[model samples]
Target: MFRTWMRFFTPGAVHHRLGLVCLGVGLQHGAVPAVGPRVLDGYVAVVISSGRGWYRTPDGRRTAVTAPALVWLTPGVPHHYGPDPDTGWDEGFVTFTGPDTATYTELGYIEPERPVVPLADASGPRDVIARIARAARQGNPLLEVETGAAVHELLVALRRARADLAPDGDPVLHALARDACTGMTVADHAARHGMTPAELRAAVRRVAGCSPKDYLIGIRLGRAQELLATTELSVAAVARRVGYDDPAYFSRLFTRRVGAAPVRFRAQQSRAVPDDWNEGLQEDAEPGPPVAEPVDGP
Candidate 1:
């Protein structure tokens, strides 16, 4: 029998205000039977630590596997994949759910309606698999936090493995874009980073093909869409938190950028799109912009 839980690290449990499924890992062995394709309930990722097999999907498809590879299965996508009966496979797998996981779908990480990404190298996934298995078996309170961190690490490794797969976009530019979208002006961010606005704009354009301000707006709009979908905040409240003071202006900007009013955007998002993100929803109640706390309280 395949073990769903294994013993490893003892990270404490995590509490998510918004919904996020638990993180867990397992290893299993099975011979692929000629059965109907299995559709994933959510996001399922498999790292073939060692195996030889072939997987197929409808529309006449096949993935020949030997050595280590990753397979990602997104929710509701139908596909048939399993080990060859001749050489039954050994596999390590994990499952997780949250807004970020949903975002991966948008980014095409779990697409092709094909939910698997076979890693070219096994070492990274192997180590992470061990850690997660141990943590699950131990059942530590901090498992959520630890498991989340481990998932992030695994994603980073996967990004490295698939770096050539993404467009040439600077990570710094992406950070700046996010900062700008959250209401930081290009001039303000440039000043903070010891660069003039023109210099910052030039750098951003070179990599992201957009001016700093435009990129920022894109980032902010994306965040607003997330909030509108997941929270009960009024349009004005969402605007204010995202750095817009006038709710009317925010609605106009949302319509111009996102092609819909805030209310409509929220409706569309909830109806079909599932957002697992919960980050910016709490900002409205956070008193003010985040600041470093005093090292030692008076």
Candidate 2:
């Protein structure tokens, strides 16, 4: 028989504060049933590793579902889908909901308009599902929080696995980041890249979920923060390093966005750095081991 297992959760009110809660997770293969032609209260991401089927959109149009694809079922949106019972394809899915789902939607991570997405590879996201499945153990004390955290990882994995992200996602974003610390206006950057200001804005918005000016400014501030935390650079020097020649203006912006002035932020980070401080995982790295929980032994 093809494998099938699942667990549903009712995370407490406190778990919702994690910004995203894992409502449930499952894996099924062969003889799977069709879902919906109905609306959902939360969200579900159906990852098809090996299968062929069809899905209905909000407007009642039908779309093909092939292997290595994702079907996003959003809240209140009518969706219907299932695998071909004759072939019985492998499927994995997770349901999630939280206040941050809106923000994630805004950031283009949750594309409601494009519910069916092609994935470059299914292994990464499936690995996350495996982790979540392990955390679904009965009576596990940290099950809620552990599964909740895995939801964040799953989203990131799915984003990275997008078929369109290959050969480097976007040249424009890389170019913008490269010149982020340069003192160039949005118009100037656009002109240099042979794009009109409006085109630049649209491109950045589509890729980064923000305007070009805001995108560049974000990168600049991020660098400034890193320098402040890891180096003894003065505020003026840090400002210059991050393309802000005006130290006073930089301080104001930093305070407004970060809730602390540069000097104060630096002071707060004055705690000594650990020897292996930079050993943290890279953006696309696999998840580290889960927090240790004692296993019952007979």
Candidate 3:
């Protein structure tokens, strides 16, 4: 939910619909609308937040998307889509044009000759739309840049998620998952796999492409991302929520792992202020833990 929100709000900086524009189509909770086989005036991205749907492209190829999935469509591409009548559907989308579209084209994230790869990642699709939606409502000055960043994030997330789902199923992956999920110490993780830490590190490196610690950090950061983008919690609150009790330590770790401080990072990813914050919710008067200073700059 946080990921989705971040993606939706990330594009909020875009307002004038510049020569090339990116605008949300809408967000529907209960059911997806039956949309066209005709061309949209601009590019389109269709993401299923929940339920299921089928999309048909100009060339007659068909694809199915369920809860947490995305189907990108290029402008001038004739397409038709609708929810599965029996199951119903909920969906969100963004329409964008401008310099970034060219970037997507160059990267082959989008294809001018065709709709290209209808990239599908349940999380990627959800997060991208959520970020865009957030930016839309916030109406920030940096919207386009944030939305562009969100686009890049989606592509990277899709690539990593695809690799994880590969059919080979390397034995070392089990150790990786365990460390990433349990927050176990290096020695403990090795013991769980019945190996010395040195040997465990070698095995993980050979198969997973990063050190075990780095891998675990990535997993934790991904979770932290989800929390920060969706919840109304303060930076310190979100830090604790994601397993780092020491907010200062978490900020440093987050910067090392995610490339930015949590507050600005979340701000860049999506502009939506939390609901309570928007409603002018005040902090409780009771004294609390020492307030650690957040790091400045990216």
Candidate 4:
């Protein structure tokens, strides 16, 4: 009969769009009966670490809960879920909300329509939830911030795991996507992986819907944006950090791709709060100057 529950009543306005103002996190075991048939005011994510259970939706749909799976309970949605009577499972859960909630929903990252999502790997989510629980129990000074950060990490892990499950998912491409900041030439990257440039291009396009060069440049540009927004680095320094030694070329590419010059973009970001800064960034804007072909790095 291992059971622990820690609840948090967070102060309002602590987090605007995506705040962890209130959280109810815990681990439970020991034949607990189904609880709910109720509605909640915020989003709740439940991760089953072991054993089995069941979840019931407002529409009278019952879903069998299996180990290493996640169930998302959207705000204002009626739901009920709990462990099996005979083999009560271990469970970890966190409730959170923020302005970015809608953004995530729009991106299909957190699907309210699909409550139960099977996690290819559950350890990451489990560890995050455990951290949230511990922070809540200790009444840490930065509990709100800590929990909010952990929630963000949990979301990222969920998205990655889900992406990995895609039919055309390629882990190698995924790694390259993350390491795009390295600024390696497409040919060099391909050679490092024992793949010809053409084969690598096809693989990246298959999973990322873009040529390897474009994919890598997109990653570099994204990093540049982050640096511009969060740091006081000059344009040339930012360009170098993202792997471009030619600052002038980097500036042209960034302006074309991001719809604003790096300096102007940084100015706008500086004027806005960090959390809401990116709201003004243009997405999928018309392509700028045609991206030059990838060249071997010096």
Candidate numbers sorted by lDDT from highest down: 2, 4, 1, 3
Q: What does candidate 3's lDDT look like per residue over 1-298, in tens digits?
A: 2122223322333433442445443566554456787786567666565677787867788877665555667766788877787777666666666566675565445545643233334566566657766766554877776665555565445444342344345666665664453435666667777888888777666446556677666776786787677666677766654445577888898898788899888887754665765342332354244432221111
Clash totals for all candidate models: 22, 0, 24, 4
Work out candidate 1's RMSD over C-alphas: 14.7
Give one digit per residue, the lDDT tens place, for model 1 in 1-298.
Answer: 2223333332233344233444567777656344248775656667777767777766658878665677776677676777778777778777766667755544444444544455556777668867777767444776777676677566555544442333354666756755643546667777767877777776665444557767767776787787788777778777766767667877998899888889888887854333455544654554344322111111
Q: List the residue pairs that clash in candidate 2.
A: none
Best by TM-score, which number? 2
Estimate the lDDT of model 1: 0.63
Instruction: Compare candidates 1 and 4 on TM-score and give the better one.
Output: 4
lDDT scores of the candidates, listed in order: 0.63, 0.83, 0.60, 0.74
RMSD of each: 14.7, 11.8, 14.5, 10.3
Ranking according to TM-score, highest score first: 2, 4, 1, 3
Backbone clash tally for model 4?
4
lDDT of 3: 0.60
Could you tell me how far off, in angstroms, the CA of residue 156 lies in candidate 1 after the best superposition?
A: 2.2
Which residue ranges in model 4 land beyond 4 Å of their true spot? 17-22, 162-217, 220-253, 256-298
Local lDDT at 96 for model 2: 98
lDDT of 2 by residue, 140-235 (tens): 999889999999999888888888776367888898899887766787778888988888888878777788877877888898888788765678
